[model samples]
Target: AVPEAADVDFSDVAGGAWLMDHIPWTEASHRIGALNATAEIARVLRIAMGEAVLSVERHTWRLNEGVTQVWQYFPADLYHLSARFTPNQGPHDQQAETHQQARPTDSQGG
Candidate 1:
């Protein structure tokens, strides 16, 4: 997913402006269902925030505040399956030539 222009700014007003680009809940729901069957959707959602990720189970449902809570048929077996939000370290910092170079003479005891 491409980074949304709004995500680059941290100001409240700037961030709030992004609400206008919010995907329709109905459409997200459909996509979630379709994704559950074929993809690891949590990774896709991570692109938007670039910080937090969203995870969901096929049996889960959205309850409120864009939050999805797990639903168990048995009351005694009720449990909460929450999303694990992990911060991304952006891209790795490395040069192609660094990896291609062999060990130096010092390390090789030459």
Candidate 2:
């Protein structure tokens, strides 16, 4: 289930940055903890991709442009996670093109 918008907090950007910087990347537990922490951050920000608000996609938390006062969420944490999690890497352009093709067209031609 998606987390509620109110339940998500995006105020820990600095803390998350510190954790990402200090954690020993070689430790498996640390990596997992970082992932969990990222998830927690997502929970707080109420990120949602495509249609569902608050649903995390490919380990990314999507946020509205202006909802959170913060300009960026967990910049360091997300960078570290991206380097550590191969699957979390974003889809290539080809895959994105295919997905776009499959999406139902909107009446307004969106």
Model 1 — which ten-residue stretch has the worst lDDT? Answer: 71-80
In the range 14-97, model 2's lDDT, one tens digit per residue, is 543443443312222111222223455556544332222222222212232221222233322223222223555663322211
Q: In candidate 1, what are the lDDT values of residues 67-95, reduced to their tens digit?
A: 22342121111222324333653334321
lDDT of 1 at 5: 46
Please list all clashing residue pairs in model 2, or write none if there are none: 8-44, 9-44
How do all models score by TM-score? 0.17, 0.17
- Residue 17, candidate 2: alpha-carbon lDDT: 49
| Model 2 misplaced stretches (Cα beyond 4 Å) | 1-16, 28-105, 108-110
TM-score, model 2 to reference: 0.17
Q: Please report the TM-score between candidate 1 and the true structure.
A: 0.17
